[model samples]
Every structure is written in C-alpha cells, then in structure tokens.
Target: MEAQQKIREQPVDLAILDIMMPGMDGLQLLKSIRGSHHFPVLFLSAKSQDHDKILGLELGADDYIAKPFNPLEVVARVNALLRRVHHFDVPAPPPEPEAKQLVLGALTLDLKECVLYVSGEPVMLTSTEYKILKLMMEEPGRVFTRKRIYEAVWEDFYMYEDNSIMVHISNIREKIERDSKKPEYLKTIRGLGYKINAPAEN
Candidate 1:
C-alpha cells in the first residue's frame, strides 16, 4: 500500500517488489500497479520461490532477481532496464530531402529546372555541357580525368580521343569563367585531370 501511494504521488521510472511482503504481497502490488501504471516492474524472490518468479513474469513483471543475488548484479539489471526505456521513449529525427541544386563559386546548377546561373545571371547550356558541369559540381575539388568525363557525360565507352572532352571543357570555361585564358573555376591539373575549384572564402 505504501508503494502504491508513493507511485500515485509521483512519477516512477521503475518499481522493485519482493514477492513475500506483509498484507499485499509483491504479486498483488504488481497487479494493482499494472491496472493504472506502465513503468517497469522488477521482482525479488528467494531461490525457493522460482515458481513465484515465473508467475510474476506472466503477471507483467519486467524482470526477476533471486534472493542470493549480488547487490551489484541487481543494480546492473535495473540500470540496463532503465537505459532501454530511455532509448525507446525518444522520438527519431525525420529524414532530410535530397538536394535539388549544386553550387561552386559563382555557378549554381538547378537540378529541377536544368538551369545554370553564373553570378545570379542565367547561362544557357547544351545538354552535354550541362551533364559535364553537373557531374563536376556534384563533387567540387575532385579531379576528373578525360576518360572518366567522356564515359559519364556521353554514357559511352571512351576511346583515346581527348578533343571532345577538351572542347567541352573550353566551352564551359568560356561560359562560367571570368577569363577563359586564366580560368578561375575550371582548372587544368597538370598531367592529372581537370577539377572545378571553388574560390577560397574571403
């Protein structure tokens, strides 16, 4: 009854009950608690009361510890149960939506409208040029070899030809760069490959 009153008076994270208490036994107290409360309940019983422990579980007890148990073991079990309750009670965060635009320096590629903006000015792009620019913008600072660029944008196996890729890179630089001769965004990586370099933050 005292336990019941304490539970009613305040919110309880857990309840510990001995199966052989005076007047209202632990089993009876658990039954009363189950009627109106949902906090975790643990049963304490003598090894001889193994049957009572099983019965306590069927009557809605979360766990049971034998009488000859170590105090540390009981404390460990209680902490584990409370950790589970705390973990499960938390709400999961909502997933974020996929990005619809890619940006590098003054360039902004809108995936939905298939448009590229240079310093807030709309720049027209051919389908092939757009595909090439979009791929580089997706992963800024990562170098892309001529073969990789050709295979990705054209969706065909690349031969040892470099003119197509070179022409496209030149055209893109003419459109997005402040000076095609001294390109700021599209950079030649000297015997390696090309990459879109975002301007350093001021």
Candidate 2:
C-alpha cells in the first residue's frame, strides 16, 4: 500500500515488481493497481509456465519476464511497449477523408485518457463511445463500416449490430458538438459510416 500510494502520488513511468513480494504478493498488487490505475507493470517471476505468463498478461500487466532474464532485454521490451502505447496516445490524423480532426481544424482526442476536448471544453463520453471514437479517431476521415466498428469494440463478432454504433455515435456527438444533429466532431459519411476528422496521431 505504501509503495502503491507513492506510485500514485508521483509520476511513475513504469513499475517493475517481483511476483513474490514480501507482503502483498505480485498478482494481488497487479490486480489492485490495474483496477484503480493505468500504470505499466512488468512482472518478474521465476515461474516459466505458460499459464503464469497468461495470468499476468490477462491481469493487465504490461510485461511478464521470466526471472534470470536479461536486464537489457527487459528494458528493451518495456521501452518498446511504452513507445507503442505512448506514441499512439492521441487520435491520429487521416489523410483520406475530411473527417480527420486535423482537417476539421481544432479537436483534441486524448486516446490514452479517453478524453475529447473541443476548445478546451471536456466532451464526456461513455466506454462504448470512447472505444468507437478511438478506433475512428486513429484514422480520421476513414469510413469504418458497422462491422469494423463492432469488431473494434465488441469481442463477439457474430452478435455485432449497427444500431449500437449509431447510438454511441449520437451520444458522443451530443457531448462534443454544439449541435448533435449537425455534428462538428463526430460526423456521418452518408451511406458509409462515422468518422472523426484529424483526431490525434501523434
């Protein structure tokens, strides 16, 4: 608890914890942190079982390195994961369509934070709204079919529907745009689907 509190108070870029901690144990700590915070965690464990790796990964740990692992290798993997996640922290600008936020002029989509900002105002969104936005925001102006959007948000592919997507989009636009009907941020592509316009690539 002390270590975790310190981590929460300070800006911890990453946390390297041994699976066998003195008091709380690694898995419990990982679960707790994952539930409350979104910090990257690298698990160090002597258990080389595939099950162990799967458990750690399933628990939202950033990396699961076997004990006696090379420090250089661990650092490289951690750095790589950070680069991939951090570099794509914001929405991406699309080159194909006018739906790009970059093209639309001024909209901030913080992908990591799952936040939408228009002229510094916070545009509230739900989990579904944020996921859909993140997918389209990654490539603004790109027309994503309902199937694609469904797959992006939902795990079960067969049960996907367009209505849910539309509803989420409506909810999202209501929060972000001055006029939900004639949206500025989230826009429809007629026969196609929804797009966000240059969102946040970098």
Per-residue lDDT of model 1, residues 1-202, tens digit only? 7888988887777888888899898989988886765466777788445466556665666667778888987886677556534322134345447537898778899875566899999886644566778889988899999988866754555645434466667778888988899988999999888999886677
Cα lDDT of all candidates, in order?
Answer: 0.73, 0.63
Which sections of candidate 2 miss by over 4 Å?
A: 84-112, 115-202
Instruction: Give the lDDT of residue 65 in candidate 2.
Output: 75
Give candidate 1 regions above 4 Å deviation.
1-99
Clashing pairs in 1: none
Q: Which candidate gets the maximum lDDT versus the true structure?
A: 1
| Deviation from native of the Cα of residue 120 in model 1, angstroms | 0.6
Q: Give the CA lDDT, 0 to 100, for residue 189 in model 1.
A: 97
TM-scores for every candidate against the unseen true structure: 0.50, 0.46
